[model samples]
Target: MPSSIPRSAAVSSVVAAALAAGLLAGAGTASAADVRIHDIQGTTRTSPLVGQQVTGVTGIVTGVRTYGSRGFWIQDPQGDDDSATSEGLFVFTSSVPTVAVGDAVRVNGTVTEYVPGGLNSGNQSLTQLSRPTITVQSSGNPVPAPVTIDEESVPDAYAPEGAPAAGGSINGLTLDPETYALDYYESLEGTNVRIGTSRVVGATDPYSELWVTVKPWENRSERGGALYGSYTAQNTGRLQIQSLTPIAQQPFPTANVGDVLADGAEGPLDFNQFGGYTLTARKLGTVVDGGLEREVTEPQHKNELAVATYNVENLDPSDPQEKFDALAKAVVENLSAPDIVALEEIQDDNGAKNDGTVGAEQTLKKFTEAIVAAGGPSYAWRSVDPENNKDGGEPGGNIRQVFLFNPQRVDFIDRPGGDATTATGVVEGAYGRAELTHSPGRIDPANTAWENSRKPLAGEFVFRGRTVFVVANHFGSKGGDESLTSHHQPPNRSSEAKRLLQAQAVNAFVKDVLAVQKQADVIVLGDINDFEFSATTEALTDGGALYPAVKSLPVDERYSYVYQGNSQVLDQILTSPGVHHFEYDSVHINAEFADQNSDHDPQVLRFRP
Candidate 1:
């Protein structure tokens, strides 16, 4: 049986017996001297005396959580010399205890290794006192002063490279309290600590949890907010804030990046599954928003051609009509019904039926019908279906990229030789510009780099007598990647290398077209699944072959996705040199709201073509 238990449930009989005994300290006090908190919390995540029963554990109650795993944390007034071991411990009472904050209590309980997820879950294990029996020695005792955590307290690096012991995870590594962030947090686990003069780095979640960073980044910090961890500099200061108070009494305030916890959050440090190190805030201060608001792009110019890229998030025929209607509204109302839209994740006719159906004609027709019904112009679309299971996405869905263009605004030039197996190539055409042999064709579909991924769909459109080439892509995802709070300091990004190759393939095709016509209007856009500052983008923009359209916006305004309170850019619209001086808008319709239609926000670029 797994050790993972519901927070509201009771522990095993052994732990229950210990708890019953501890609570029934009855009438007499034990003669045993109070043990220092650090003695029970050794240098590692697990206690040295784990699985053993101990008595006279003394401390002042610092915080009490009444709802789940009804428990309170206690910290010793006089701590030990070893900075590697924490001075605080949680007493799991299973129900609200009679103990009050600032009360000097001596607890008798069994020490155990409580893995938040499970023993095999690779989550950080917390050392806690379970089934505790408490004896309140006195009331009105002063709580120990919280240890202030600032830049000097946390290390620059987050963790060591490999296993602590052979075949073990970095979680079991020996403590380097002053050198690694993981080691430092392990040292202070279950301790009443303080983050003085702190600012919120991430937004507050529905669960009332927020992330903050105490230390400043060595490199020029972006708006004093912590960047996601990297190899060169692991963001060691980032810490999650978990409120212990009930939602009704103390609802967590809504916040954004650069918000201030003016009084500085103070709490007992805890290690949990979702976030590695969290402070169960005993006292939460005021939150000041950094003036971050939902961004709106300027409307399109009548004479200029407007093109947009949107990830429809697996729209298939089998999906509900409301989803299609909502997506059409997003395109018309939010995206302003651009002349041309590059759409990714358009699924097959009978989505996920696993019957080898590959056409998306019904899906396209339904979307167009919805668009017209939503007060938008009727749109025609083009797409090439991939062989079953060859294109990576939702299994059995066969998701692919497609282009939706209004006949009143642009014309999609059609040619021959477009099929699932035949790769599209740049060829000389009648317009004195490079053209695709097939208007809507897969680019290098058979290439190993595109294995199990959506092949880029290249299409040529004539707008105002000028040919504009558009390549719609949906790259391999960042799936199976390690978590940001993983045991590894800067968790490995195994997906980046594959994205680089995809970028290279697309870049080579762009270069081939540009070589023939230096001023070719080429638009490469879709769910790139990478940041603007990443190696994948670098590959796309090498030697100024293409310019990222999002760069036109202010640095603070360049984002299309928000995850874990972080506003970031994963979808982008990059264009060739010919298509310059364009009005670009990263319309913020979805990413920030709970009622989002898609994970990605659509982007539109209006330019003369």
Candidate 2:
């Protein structure tokens, strides 16, 4: 939730007027002239023109300053019919006057694109009048929003008789006015109001002043406000909260009924002490869109074939062919070589050769030869050729994790419909609203069925006496997607978002596989750009159908990658239900191998059959 500028018409006018009154702002930010919002979208009034200077726009104001910021929403005459509504979501300056929900006023500002979907049609990008240029022609009466009255945290004194709200102000909390819009809290701080169920942090009593660190229930639960809110600005040390309820939490299977939770306050570590358990606390930080979370550890079986995954850093693509000379040796010698290993982001023959030179064959040959040179070439490798497209990053026309295995262990099975790029078909079942960059698109070169930066390469392998279905993949990436990256002429930030959807596709595919192979053994390992607790992973794992290997490990060594100030476990070893039946020696993260030169670390899971 971002604290942004107020969207009041009065605020918009005053700020823009103040700036132009003194000096001009940057040319890129401010336009010499403002265009009527009605004119900018010459073709369709509903069409969105992102960040265009707009003026002469008027409508019935629909919303006022609410949580996270001070903002106003205006709806066009057709606000009754969503398809015909206009004046998209916009946030304006603070100096502007307060406009009620029904006020009619002339507005001047910028018209920016909302999200790809209309979910945020209410928040069009904006600029505003520095002076009170736009006049309130008629004072619009207050109109109640079409939904339920929000539960707030306001004190009983200001709150409506019986309801418990979540509005409050704690003095020492120190909210930075400059960073987050100040006006957001001015009205609610120290006031008594009902807030939504999702905003509560740590843990608090239904209506009491107590703060509980851990949530009281195992799964999603709700609590009613016992007494009306009373704490207000007058009670400096006490803050009052309103509407309260706990949402769903996926507990780690290893957790006991009363175990206290430490949602990895330090690092991303998960341990499966009792085979399955889950412990959920309040949200720590929101990585991706959802907040951080943890689940019960998933045990690796000792009597089952082992599988592993790794990024291998840049792997010295400078001479991809020659580079394999020592590359294979490093992998086989120091690494606990599993039955299969999926590698991500390597150039065939080094440098940038999407062509046939220095492909998986050469690189994998290096590993087998290295093992042979070491007197133990016990394993063989099988991989798919790059797609017909000739992409450079991966062997299959993209930079991806290729699978290498011992042919003696498992027999390979053919899946005709499995790898045939069912891009859109694979991810359509994921649950959750697709926003801005993560939404589905029409079929085209860019929006084809496959959600992966490249299509997912699936295959079958047999281990021991049983055949195992395997899908070794590298889903997608976050960096280099914004139009600002150099990999292409223009980076597309939406691609970063699409990576999450790609993860959904991976999740959907796994769910589909699980449905078909209820008792079948499956090994799913890959570098999914999202972390373990993200909604993407939640959707991918689909409520514990496939267990994540990291959850079973101790917290100290769980993370496979570190970024900014947070250490994350984005790469992972996910297990089908069958794989969890055995005891595993360990799941290792060879972070040192890939740290300086690359974005990912190598992960190895060892199980002794």
Candidate 3:
């Protein structure tokens, strides 16, 4: 998760952080005898909770929740001790019912350490507690500002009108990124910040609209590299920038607020050197005919247009007729329902969907009918899959991700680099990454053959004059060493590292495409497979032009898939700088859907110009 980071400090020696429990597997700063729960502190320097404890512990209660048959929530409206890291007596369901966010209460819990799950699992800890629960009593209270936005409204209202702002302190707290291994920043819900726009090496313009970095980049140990001072990532790799939309404030019609990193903008406007077929960041600012704030027009009609991507879990046809039927069903019923749809797992070369038997032969035919039936009447599907489905590059997986666009909205642009001008990078590159790593094991399960799969695909399209850059991804499965079996090794980080390389290639490609085209209109949409805050995505956008569509939406609705009780922002839509031109609205997840279908939900967006 992007929230819980393992490393506590970027200092020269990682020895201390490595010894810390949960935070790392190395050394400790304090002697064992002197270690105490109260010693817990925030991770960052600007934090008030870092080296401090609570005083006058009086606050009100807010809300509580008791899940299934086991867990319960204990919340205090005030008096927060951000460093409460242990499974201390400060929280327990037995006495939680008596408390709420509006009532005042005193809290005493050991600031516990965090234990991470993926990536840097060895360097993180949590501010957890387990007992004595919460206490509360009624008291005077200041009505809190509404934290949620109108779920159905456009995000443009959030554009900053005044000056740039910073995410403010919350409950006197901050988390250190390096040594603490604390997973996240203890930000107050809804706090906003204004951030600078960013760009990548090959992409054009402001590069990215909203940028995410704790500070400018500072190179460290050869193995662990952090981007723009955000967190530790790989070094010497490429870097890209992320954009954020600052919330509007008073006086200034649109005051850019703090950075929770959410910005909303619609689609693209085709205008590139390819004679005009690239995504642009300026789409959002364009005024529409009626003067009526556009919910879909400006930028690109995302709100008015629906774009979907699905794994179709198992849509490959074994024979002919069946293949055609399944494809028709997916298009007319599922995929074609959206303005644009990207699909994965369909056989491109294998003669599967042939005859009435349902093979992979006429895969294209199946989709076209659905598009026509779904009303895209003249819709055309794009295919980049191998000609024979025979093992070419990676052999583990097949079924390349393909695109389907509405000719009315999108006009196919030139390849990443072509004649009039070279598309440069994206042809076979990614931005915002330094170096790459590799898995150590040889006879690993993935070595079993099914692990090697078709990589990813990207394309440029012009929608309503805006250029949209779409990158499609299908990551290596969490097979092999992931859920350990002693006989075999765990999924190799090194192998996944190759995916990182591929991701880097994608980033570099985006940057190169922008080199000749200075407009920041771009969107990288696909199955990232990693969460918004994961190492892979971070590496891809450390300093490039891309925005996560989910962030602009409500946190609860940000997830595309659920795993182990937690939701993951897997499939995503990331945009470039032009994102600031319009207002953004996150599409609600369609959850009623079933799974053999897939473990993820498709996200929709509505951009108001």
Candidate 4:
């Protein structure tokens, strides 16, 4: 939330005294200015007259600021009649001009486009008037009526074609105020808007921002949040509420999905880099909690073994001791310290130092030490070091998947002769069942799909009388993919191809083990970096050889990660046909909270082996 300057009438009189004090108020009006607010705002994302000087822009003062470089916002009472252009614009006076809301004023300034992020970012810049000289034409002038936004007004689709050639750039296309979500938001950028009694769709973020849906979400859930679907069908009804009220002045409201905003909110619309369009609230209403509670899963029974997957978000020995402690608590208290836990993003011994330090013995040791200190069962880890710099992640961080198991409950089958370069294959071991040639070895290490990515770690673990093969994976991320509001319709999922290939490789390996033993209990789990309803998951579970355990959880509780306003599942556990009738839980210790230790929530599965 950016700081705002106080709009005191006394201050306005002191700055623009010639008009506000008495003279200009008596005159009542100024001659018609050559340029209007719409001319400076234009229809596109970038201002058409950026860097050009404009004179005599007239509008009523809608908002005034006194903090930082104090300034005020002005909006034309009668706009250009073009639905595409915004009527309001911010006037930066550098604490010079004191303007009160409802004072009609004439401003002269340079038209500028301020990019929130740098130029390289695809984000559109904010159009503003800088170094403005203000003259109050009249005081007590009525401001423009705020446009009301309701469910029927928001469109289902989010954006037009996102590619540059397809009018993806904000400046490239003519916005349709009623058709697409992006268009509707762009049309209202920098204008006064009102949201009638809406529901909180997204949990409040640390910045005091929450997403709300006006009314009648397309796939409305009982929780008052819109259910996530294909990206093409953007959840248009959902709008982000950004509080301009400083935390010290008024605290940002805390809310969860299904919470009701009885009075809704009204604010000046703003566009920023993080979320496309946002409302800087002038009046924020009350929040009624949905009473959503964190779910506690049942503990594993005597004969039952619980296996879990957790992404520690690149944990290293150098990380804060508290982070490790918090993670360990989530595993012990929230996840019940499963018999076997597949850990992702475990860096090498040197942490992030780039000197070819591949062994993670020190890293795993510190984590297990913290777990024990946190009252969790003492755990042992098994992992094959990867060729440094070959696995993708941070430049110096060789992030890989590792297995942590409670030795008292499960035995990790370790075979000799495993190395970073060689691929692991299914082979006959002492038990005469299908087994990894090398426990905790990379599966198809040389596969092109695993190139510069985290290779799957296949390790065999035996609990009681059952043997379960676990494949721990961290797939390629959705890095270069377009945002939800991208110009390209159905924003391209650029990372899907590589993940599909990785999924195929893992599926092939699972098939080999199942071929050796039709009922081989193989568990593949980790941060797949995709949804359960994605093609990547389809590739992994093709032929019904492995089924996603997440699908078994209730739909509303299926999410393990929350991005933007969507509570989506990016981490998943897929089990072989041999493993059935298991209880699963997507532990929600993180993701929904503002002070989450990790970006992802861990999941656990319990069943009789």
- The lDDT for every candidate, in the order shown, is 0.78, 0.39, 0.36, 0.78
The TM-score between candidate 1 and the true structure equals 0.76
Error of 3 at 532 (Å): 1.1
Model 2, residue 244: distance off in Å is 51
Off by over 4 Å in 4: 1-33, 40-53, 64-72, 80-82, 91-103, 108-143, 160-173, 216-225, 247-251, 258-262, 318-321, 348-358, 429-432
Model 1: how far is 139 from its true place, Å?
A: 8.1
Question: Lowest-lDDT window of 10 residues in candidate 2?
Answer: 268-277
lDDT of 4 at 290: 73
The lDDT-based order of candidates, best leading, equals 4, 1, 2, 3
Best by TM-score: 4
Model 3's TM-score against the true structure? 0.41
Q: Residue-wise lDDT of candidate 4 within 1-609, one digit each (tens)?
A: 432323344433332442233311122122324688887777666566665567889998876655543566788878878988999888877664577888998888876665443333444556788767889889998778888888777776677664465444544566777677788877887788889878777778766788888756566643455667555545778788876555788888888766777788877777665666777777789998777655566789989989999999989999999999998888888888899999999998778899888889989999999999999999998988888899999878899999999999999888877778888899765656898888878899899999999999999889997899999999999887756754345556778999999999999999999888888899999999999989999999988789999899777667787766677889999999999789988887677655577888898988876
- Greater-TM-score candidate between 2 and 4: 4
Regions of model 1 farther than 4 Å from truth: 1-36, 43-74, 90-184, 194-201, 204-208, 212-237, 245-266, 282-292, 314-330, 347-375, 386-390, 416-422, 515-518, 542-544, 551-554, 592-595
User: 171 in model 3: Cα distance from truth in Å?
Assistant: 37
Quality of model 3 by C-alpha lDDT: 0.36
Per-residue lDDT over 120-169 for candidate 2, one digit per residue giving the tens place of the 0 to 100 score: 11111122222223556777554323221122221212211111221111
Q: Give lDDT for model 2.
A: 0.39
